[model samples]
Target: MPTDQIDIERYHQLALQKQKEHRLFLATLKRKAPKNLDKIVQEVHTEVFSEIDCTKCANCCRTLGPLFTEADITRIAKHFRMKLPVFEEAFLKTDEDGDKIFQSMPCPFLGEDNLCSIYDVRPKACREFPHTDRKKIYQINNLTLKNTLFCPAAYLFVEKLRERV
Candidate 1:
């Protein structure tokens, strides 16, 4: 769907309205996930992404900060020719789980065009945003549920998954 066609407010309302049902569905799937769950998720992910252009939305970047691993810090620091400590001090903060995350929302690297200025060196978590195609998807039911609030693609993936499996 085109950027203009994505109604984020409507998505949020639907996701919230269906949150309890989605949670129950995810719990059931976790207990008896299909043997081909990964394949099914991958197929749905492909179909959803083909239709939703992320650059047009960028809601994940705008509303959520990606967890930055040590390797992610090293790579990004090197990309900026800065020391890891300096980079961390400037852009990161430790979350309650002690994971490093960007200090602000609408990520500093997010350009006015809704593109990532550091796309080539974005964090591992950023690279895997939404993570709809990951293996053993039932393992991250909670994460997927949260993502439905932030990503139209993630929301659509779940909607389609419900229809398929």
Candidate 2:
């Protein structure tokens, strides 16, 4: 199992690099200025994802809660071979807005290596981790900022984008 602690110097360096990249991306977006931002964001997401690897930074699993949908519950429940009710009682609960989420911080499924224990059958939200590719990308400004600590890639993406703008 890999340790969760990232080298402070290396982590900071990478974070700064990512920030720079985000600025560049934003600058390009402003210059080219896509017809529809939603589609453009997805395209940029695909391109950025091709360049940046998430496995190298599993901060999402370490921080933040994934808003679980009903399907997330049923599939994850099946992954454990337990009824949805049993799984919910064991590892999940409804938050203030009726969204099902993990009981506490640091996902329970996160293994020592920063890999999800049930990666293949993980929740829909987990499958869509680092959801920069989605249409409502701008709406998740809060999430993108929060991901800075957990995902160096996100920091780089945003930083580079800002530069482009």
Candidate 3:
């Protein structure tokens, strides 16, 4: 299916309803997931991403900005020619976990076309959004489950993965 034509809100609702089932399914995979699952998932991810242009659906950047690591902070600050403290004061804030995140949603770095203004130096978390191809997929099963709601590709990936496993 073409991701641009996907009904995001409908999928979000469906994903919410399937959360428990998905979790249990992931747990089952924790023990039984193929040793080559990462390679398989990578292939799926490539195919899915080819069909889905992220620039058309920046839901992840629009809804949940990435958590910034210290390195991300330094790189971004330098990109803007600002000091870390200055950058933080202007655009970042601490989350409940004390991790640095954007001060606002629809991230400040996100352009009108859903492209990242700082794409080259984006946070590691942003680079790895909807981490479907991460090795030892079980390690990030919970995160992947959460991603399914906002990311059409993730939702489809999980559905496809179910069939594969």
Question: What ranges in model 1 sit over 4 Å off?
Answer: 1-5
Give a tens-digit lDDT track for model 3, residues 46-145: 8788877777778898898888999999999999999999999999999999999999998988998678999999999999988987888888888989
- Which structure is stronger by TM-score: 1 or 2? 1
Candidate 2 lDDT tens digits, 34-80? 56777656666676787666655666776677888888888888888
Candidate closer to the true structure by TM-score (higher is better), 2 or 3: 3
TM-score to true structure, per model: 0.94, 0.70, 0.92
Ranked by TM-score, the better of candidates 1 and 3 is: 1
Per model, state how many residue pairs clash.
1, 18, 0
Instruction: Determine the C-alpha RMSD for candidate 3 after optimal superposition of all C-alphas.
Output: 2.3
Write down the TM-score for model 3: 0.92
lDDT of each: 0.90, 0.68, 0.87
Tens-place lDDT digits, model 1, residues 1-165: 554656777888889988998898889889999988889999999999999989878888889889898999999999999999999999999999999998888799999888999999999898998999999988999999999988888889889999888
Worst 10 residues of 1 by lDDT: 1-10
